[model samples]
Target: MAVRSHSTRVQSFSLSGYHGKPTRGTVTIREFNREQRMRRALEGLGKWWGVALLSVFIPVAHFVLVPSFLLYGMWQLCQRLGTAELATDAHGACPDCGTEQTFELAPRWRAPQPVTCKQCHRGLRLTVPS
Candidate 1:
């Protein structure tokens, strides 16, 4: 008896079907490409639109709605094309400002580096004892 590993299984997928999760790499950390980020920004806008219509009494509504859309567009463009960088999860926080903002990682913006904090505008770096 042999144990099978997850990635080892040869799952056959059809032309019109999905075989496995389309997303790749580790999920704990969030990574984004241009298309993916644009999609997110648009989604944020959509959510704000819904909130505006449904939650009239929402106190945070006024400040949140427009900002969501703006951040989305800005982030979408922030990510440079053909670049690879490491980013925290979408809900990740900035160590400097303490704002829960995910960084837009891009190669041209400087690849081979950890994602930056959007709010604090600081580059996220791994510390090593020297």
Candidate 2:
């Protein structure tokens, strides 16, 4: 009997033609300016507006906006309640093992989902609080 490990697994591929032939082509590497990259990205937006907008704009906007919103919301909340010790994050705790974990905003907005607990290795249902 033999035991196989994932690390030791072999990955093989083949080509139908195995002849002594010269197949060489020039490889060109062209670097684009920031504006060119942006133009190319927007060009992709023409194909799938929703996907391109969501994928490209969301992250860039989030990095520039989420932190600002979170900070301002925290500041206002703290001022209203007159408390300094406070923290806010989109997260849920593992019910089985009581391990807390943060979640992304988009998925958590949809519905409750099962998340694996790092501590007990059990599946726990997590939902964002309204």
Q: Which candidate is the best by TM-score?
A: 1
Question: Where does candidate 1 have its weakest 10-residue lDDT segment?
Answer: 8-17
Cα lDDT tens digits, model 2, 8-76, are: 111121111123221211111233334444444444434343433344456567565655554554444
For candidate 1, lDDT tens digit of each residue in 13-106? 1111022212111112344555655565566556655555554455777477655655554554444333233333333444455565434544
- Determine the C-alpha RMSD for candidate 1 after optimal superposition of all C-alphas: 16.0
Global fold similarity of model 2 (TM-score): 0.25
Q: Name the lDDT of candidate 1.
A: 0.41
